[model samples]
Target: MYAGAMKDKRSDSRLVLEKVSHSYGAVPVLNDLNLVVDPGEVVVLVGPSGCGKTTILNLLSGYIEPVSGTVRREGIIRTVYQQDGLFPWLTVSENIAIGLRSVEDPARREKELLDLIALIRLEGFEHHYPHQLSGGMRQRVELARVLAGDSDILLMDEPFSALDYQGRLRMRWELVRLLEKRPHTVVFVTHDIEEAAQLADRVLVLSNRPATISRELHIEALRPRDLTDPAVIGAMKEILKELGLQV
Candidate 1:
């Protein structure tokens, strides 16, 4: 669901960076990086570990500032992390409510919360604490919380990495379902080649260190993309080759 293109006539980008670079205690992590994400497109950053993937997510989410460039964002941003990023003490409903409470309009907030609860399929789990819920449920709560904020862009850092195979599979379908209604641009960072292929409209491959763009992939197939089809295999192979990983 490439939600929509960016609003800027200059580039159709909802978010952009100008020659962005970053460092860690004098050690360069990302150098001369520039990227643009359309308003509703999913851009996945795929690379080996320690290749500055998470750093890129951080820069976009405003958790960290760049050392040598700029991040331009068109709207409010929200993030969902691999760890679920939920307050264990809070019930699922509470977590979802916290973000909505800030919406300023009680009527709108109530309506939005109900819609998000239904979207995440967590209506009955509302009173359940994070520890009481399964991993997938916790992830849903995190997603719902992010949605409740009504952020224009969603940043996810391997939110499915910890899920079991079946859970991951279901989450992928659920994500497509959820996004269809929410329709927000997303920047997801993952090391999984197939995950990028399944979820992103565009996949940006990165170099080993001091990460830089290597290849940009466009998955033109329709969704529910067949996981084992030759078409998917061929595109995955091409991306792996571009990343210098033979498979």
Candidate 2:
């Protein structure tokens, strides 16, 4: 199964950052950073608190421009952040249907929204408002809404950081299943090593201020990886080491 999944991966570049550098009013963030995300690949960025991980996402999303190098994005990009950006007045189904507002066929659009609602496992709560759902449920709605847009690349900035321990774990699996059904080139940013190890196809560790690529680790484990598995533990340890931790 692992080999099959790997074999089906896309070989083309979906996003690339070459010698990218950025600064905020003289405060340097990324410095000569280079990275590439292939089509259908999930790449996670983890680093110190001020190490420009979020800055990388902003650059890819075109929210900010790089000062030095180039950011090449090959397809449509969508983002899912730590906060659940849902409309309080809209019901779950209504919020997800927002992505299909451009579709001219009502039947096709309704089918897509219903499929997404089921994919996120929120079928029965379609009529519920954002304020009525739990943190994890809200994040699921956010993800469903993004997937409904059929984006080529998904830029996620700590989307699950606010969840409790078990909630985060469950959501990780939830994400894997969703992507399996509808593949998207994903760039995820997080400070949690375990999260990176669990969700990434490749994990890139960044340096401190004026952050550059410190180390790149490929996660060869299959889906639904056990958090306590020796491979996962080892991967987390290596990430910690790159961050200057004694472990």
TM-scores of the candidates are: 0.91, 0.93
State the C-alpha lDDT per candidate.
0.82, 0.88
Model 2: CA > 4 A from native:
1-13
Best-performing candidate as measured by TM-score:
2
Candidate 2 lDDT, tens digit per residue, 1-247? Answer: 2234433433343899999999999899989988888888899999998789999999999999999999998777889989858889999999999977767799999999999998998989999999999999999999998888546688999999999999999999999988888777899999989999988889999989999888999988887788997778889999988888855
Check candidate 2 and list the clashing pairs: none
Model 1, span 1-247: residue lDDT tens: 3333323321333889789999999789998999989877888899999999999999998899999999988777888999859988888878888768669988888888788888898888778899998999888888888767646788999999999988987887788777776677789999888877787788899998899998898887765566786656777897889977785
What is the lDDT, from 0 to 100, of the residue 21 in candidate 2? Answer: 91
Model 1 TM-score, 2 decimals: 0.91
